[model samples]
Target: MMGEDADMRTMLAPPMSTPHDAGRRDLEQRYQRVCDLFPDQRVEIVNGRIVIREVPTLDHNRMIFRLLLQIMAFADQRGWTACNDIKLFLGTQVDRYRPDITVVPAEPRMWDAENVYADQTLLVVEVVSPSSRDDDNLLKPHSCSLAGVPLYLVIDPLEKTARLLSQPGRSGYVQQDAVMLGELLLLPDPWDLKLDTGKFLN
Candidate 1:
């Protein structure tokens, strides 16, 4: 069963108390300070909103580790690598995300020292947390699609399923496919890789 900590991790901060634009910079600065104070947590600006997240649970980290192991060799063969927690700029200054796993070139030409543009990513993945169901299934896919990320994967342990979104369009991904955790998920085109979801831990 889901726990209270999971719910707390997904809590969205209230809207900025000050006026828009006029206080955006200040708000960002304050959030930056919070990040500096708590180095272990993740603080993100999502479409100009501040979203703070606690460190991943042990189960969460294990899932990411398994994915990295499977993806590393394939990515290395093509001069690409898989990573996590790297800030990704989503076509705007105030919109950024740190996907659970990202497939990127070994030597990415970054947008900045601390960020990589979403367009530079070959794929992004997010493992669903209890309170993040909607954001993981919808908001992030839409944003990543608009930012031209080639593929987006959403793994929901609660549902024991994985959903892959691809064929990006102005609105969002043009195509989507889903399968149970025990099935193989085929990545189309350029990737041509199959993920053995049977190994994923729920």
Candidate 2:
């Protein structure tokens, strides 16, 4: 749903705060206002404010596409569902995110809806872009962890590296194992697989 009316481009915004750090209902209302107005736009509540990022660069888009395909292959072998850029409810009224790649249950709970519930999510992957570097590296990991997502993967195409963050807690991930391009990217527990990151390097 690209290129909509000019009025729909206008965003509803509120003063920023950490999600769940302040008025919960107010945050939801603020986001809902945008949702009702710009239903077609890709919007998210980041740091308790509506964050709308521009379309990704070519490198960023290619990396995201490659990773999504790789993850889908991995999930296919294990009979799990892997998807691209799907909206996630995250079980909190304050924030919702559409991860670059999302791994969920075979039958996701919120699959029928436009956005799926965070409960169905087993892993959330974010491919860092120039614009989203900080959030992908910091805020998003914390957000995904707090949402009870067991795994959070950060892929940096510029650096040709990836970080697998697991052992989620309220604060953030407790364990982090990083791998560079040409190195074996290992996923833990449920899907013990070594992912190939060579394509991401280029």
Most accurate candidate by lDDT: 1
Q: Please give the lDDT score at residue 191 for candidate 2.
A: 78
**Per-residue C-alpha lDDT of model 1 across residues 75-163, encoded as one tens digit per residue:** 89999878777888785335668788888887776888878888888889999888678778878888888888889999888898989
Q: What's the count of clashing pairs in each model shown?
A: 0, 0
In candidate 2 the C-alpha lDDT for residue 139 amounts to: 84
lDDT string for model 2 (1-202, tens) is 4545544554454546874556777777777797788766657888777877677678877887777766777788777877776887766553688788888878778834668876567788888877788888988888778777888899987677899999888878899999987778888878787778887876
| Stretches of candidate 1 exceeding 4 Å from the true structure | 1-20
- What is the lDDT of every predicted structure here? 0.81, 0.78
Worst 10 residues of 1 by lDDT: 13-22
- Global Cα lDDT for candidate 1: 0.81
In Å, residue 100's CA in model 2 sits off its true spot by 0.6
User: All candidates: CA RMSD in angstroms?
Assistant: 13.8, 12.3
